[model samples]
Target: MTQHRKRDKNLGLAELVAIALGGMVGGGIFTILGISVSMIGNLTPIAIIIGGLIASLAAYSYVKLGLYYKDEGATYSFFKRTYPKSHFSAAAIGWFIIFGYISTLALYAYTFSSYAISSTEFANDIQIRKMIAIGVIGIFTLINVLSVKGMGKIEDLMVYTKLVILTIIAVVLIQHGSTSFEGFIGDMAMDAKNSSTLSILIVASITFVAYEGFQLVINAVSEMTNPDKNIPRAIYSAIGLAVLIYVVISMGALFAIPSEDIIKNKEFALAAGAGDVLGKMGTDLVILGAILATSSAISGTVFGSSRQMSVVAKDGYLPKWLAIRKKNIPINSIVGMGVMAAILILIGGLELILEFGSITFLLVSLLMAIANYKLRDKTNSSKVLTTFSILGLAIGGVLILYYEFTAKWEQMLAIVVLYAVLALGAWIYSKKNERAKKIT
Candidate 1:
C-alpha cells in the first residue's frame, strides 16, 4: 500500500462517540462481570460502582489533555513534547497501552471460536473453535487493511449494534430473570477488609476497562470539528453511558444467578445474567454483544495506534517513512500497527499485555494531570471544573498503581521488564541518530 494515505479529514464528535462506545464496551464486560461477583460474592455491583468512579476520574484527565495538546498522538505525543527527556518512555508506554486492545482482540477471537463451534446444528464440535478463531482473525485483518474511513464506519455500526444487543438482553433479563437478593449474595470466604478491597479494586479495574475506548476518541483530535470542546464532550458522553450500562449489567448478573455459581463458573457469567430472564436466547445475545464489542475495540486501537505512530514520525522521533500520509491517512503506520496488533493476538498473553499497556497509560494519565495543572495555570482560565478534573486524576493514578501492583503482580513484573527493554531500544535508536549526525 502507498505510505501515507490521507482521507478527507480525521473525524468529528459523532464519530468520536462511536469510537469510544464501540471500543470500551467489549468482551471484558460479559466475561469479567460474573467472575467479579464470584470473587467479591454479593458485593459485585458496589465494586463496579467504585470502579466507575476511578475510571471517570482518569477520563477527566484525558479530557483536559485532549483539550490542551489537541494532537494526533493523544497522550504519547503530548507527554513527549511536554517532557522531551521522557520521549522513549512515552513511546514504550504507548506500546503497552495498545495491548489493552490486543487483549480484547484475543478475547473476541476466543468467543468467535466458541460461537462458530456451537453453531453446528448436527452435533457439538469443540475442534471447530480453533478454526473459527483463525478465520475471524484473518477476516478482521483484511478489513483493517482497508482505508481508515472504512474502519471508522464499521466501528460505529458494530458498536451501536452491540449496544442494542446488550440492551435487548438486559430487558429480557429484567422481565424473565429470577433470583432473590439473599441468594444472590453468597457465602464467600473472606475477612471484611480484604474482601472489600479486592471487590473495590476488581470493580474499579473493570470499570476502567469500560473507559478504554475514550482515549481512542482523542487519538483523532486532528480530525475533530472543534476538538477542544467536542472531544471532551465526546469523552464524557461515552463514559457516562458505559458506567450506566455496567452498573445495570452487574445488578442483572447478581440477580440472574446465585453468587456462588458466578464464582464457581466464570464462563457462565453472561449466561447466568440472561439465563432465567432471556432464557437461552438472552444468554446467546450477551455473548454476541461481547464479540461485537471486541471488534469495535480492535478497530479503535488500529486507528489510534497508527495515529500515534504518525505523530512520532512528525516529530522526527522515528523514520519519516512511518509518518508518510497518502490520501490523508498514514498508510505506513496503519499497516504497521495492524500487523503488530495481529501478531500480538497470536502470542502475548492477555493479562501481561493489559498490565504493560496499563502502566504506560497510567504514566500518561500522570503526565496529563500535570499538563492540565500546567496549562490551567499557564492560561489562567476560570474553568474551575477542569482544574479539579486534573486533581482527581493525580490522586486516581496513585490508587490505580497500588491496585495494579497488588492485584496484577506477575503482569506488573512483566511490564517492568518490558520497560527495561524499551529503554534499551531508545538508547540504540538515539546512538544511531547521533552517529548519523556526526557522519554529516
Candidate 2:
C-alpha cells in the first residue's frame, strides 16, 4: 500500500502527458516526413492534421472507456470487460494490440538506428542498421526490466528535451529556409491541383501509426493521480501537442529542403536536408532529436505494453508465464515483447512493419469506437461524435486497404497471412481459457 501511494504521488498530469507524448512522437514524425513529402509534397501537413483528427476521434472512446473501466490492459482488457462472455473477441484484440505494439517497437528501434548511424559511413548498410536496432531494443528492454520509476523519469527527460530540440530544429530550418511562404503556397497549390484527394487521404491513413502511442497514457491508469480527470486531459492534450509539432516540423522541412532531396533520402531525409542546408551542426541536431525521440518511444512502449500484455495473460488469453510480476513489473512479458520486436527487426522490412502497425492500430481503434458507441449511454459519449469516429476510422481503414492493394500487394498479402496466424493462436487460447474457467 505504501509503495502504491508512492507510485501515484510521483506521477501527475505532466508525467502522464510525457508518457503519451513519448509514445506518440517517437520516430513517427521522422519516418513519416519523408514518406509524406514524397507522396504529397507541401501538402504533408494536411495529411498529418487529418491523421491527428482521426486520432482524436479514436481517443474519445478510449477516454470514455478508460474512465469507466480504468484498466491498464487498455485495448485488450477493455474489450474483454465490455463483452465478458466472448473469449474469442478478447483473445483476438489481445493478439492484435500486443502485436501492434511489437510492430511499433520495431519501427522505433529501426528509426533510431537510421538516425544514429546517419553520419557514419555505414549509413547505407542494412545489416549494420538491423544490428544497431536490435541493440537499442535490448538496452531499453533492460532499462524497463529494472524499474518503472527510473523508466518514467528517463522518459520525462527524453520527451521534454526532444520537444525542445525538435522545436529548435524546426525554427533553425525555417530561419535558414531558401523558400518563401508565397513560393510554398504556390507549390502546394500546384501540387493540390495535380494530386488526387485519394492520394492525400491515403497518406493520412498511412500516418495513423504516428498517433498510435497516446493510448499508452491509459495503461498507466493505476499509477496516475485522479485518473478520471487526468486520463482524458493527458490523452487529448498530448494529441493536440503532437499534431502541432508534426505540422511545424513538416512545414520547416519542406521550407528548407527540396522535394527531390526528401524523396531521394527517404529513410534519413530530415538529416540529409539538415546536412545540405544547416551544415554539419544541423545534421547533428536532427540526429540527436531522432535518437532521443525513438529512445523514449522504445522505453514507453515497453513499459506500458508489457503491463497490458501481463494483464491479457492473467485473463488466460496468453501464456500464463507472462503474467508473473516482480515489484509490479511484468518481467517475462517485457522480455518476451523485446524478443519478438528484435525478431521483427531482423526479418521484417521497415515499410512492412510500418504499414502493419498503422493498419493494426487503425483497426483496433475502430473497434474501440464501436465499443464506445455501444456503451455511449453509460460513458456519456455524444452519439453524433461517436458515430463520426466510427465513420472516420472506417474510411481510414478502407483507404489503407486501397492503398496497399494498389501500391504494395506483396506486403498486404504478408500482413493478411500474419493476421491469420495470430487469429488462430487467439482462437486456440480463448477456447483453452474458457474450458479452464468452466472447470473451475
Best by TM-score: 2
Taking the tens digit of each residue's C-alpha lDDT, what string does model 1 give over 1-440? 01323335646777788888876676556556655665565566666666566567667667766676667777766666567675455655454454444555555554445443332451144345434555566565566556667777887789788788777666555445475544444432242345867446644554455456678887777666777678878888988888777767766666666566666545445654464566667657766776777677666766776777777666555666878876666777766665555565565554454444444554556566666566665434345655665565555556656766887777667667766765676555555555665798
Off by over 4 Å in 1: 1-7, 85-87, 98-138, 181-194, 264-268, 272-277, 314-321, 379-411, 430-440
TM-score per candidate, chains pooled: 0.82, 0.98
lDDT of 2: 0.91
For lDDT, the strongest prediction is: 2
Query: Residue by residue across 1-440, what tens digits does model 2's lDDT show?
Result: 01132444456898889889989998788888888887888999999999999999999999998988878899997788888888998999999999999999999999999999999999999999999999999999999999877888999999999999999998888888999889989999999998899999999999999999999998887777898789999999999999999998998899999988888777788899988888999999999999999999999999889999999999888999999998778999999999999999999998899999999999999999999999999989999999999999999999999999999999999999999999999999999998998999
- TM-score of candidate 2 to 2 decimals: 0.98
Displacement of residue 19 (Cα, Å) in model 2 is 0.8
Model 2 spans with C-alpha error above 4 angstroms: 1-9
Measured with C-alpha atoms, the lDDT of residue 311 in candidate 1 is 70
The 10-residue segment with the lowest total lDDT in model 1: 115-124
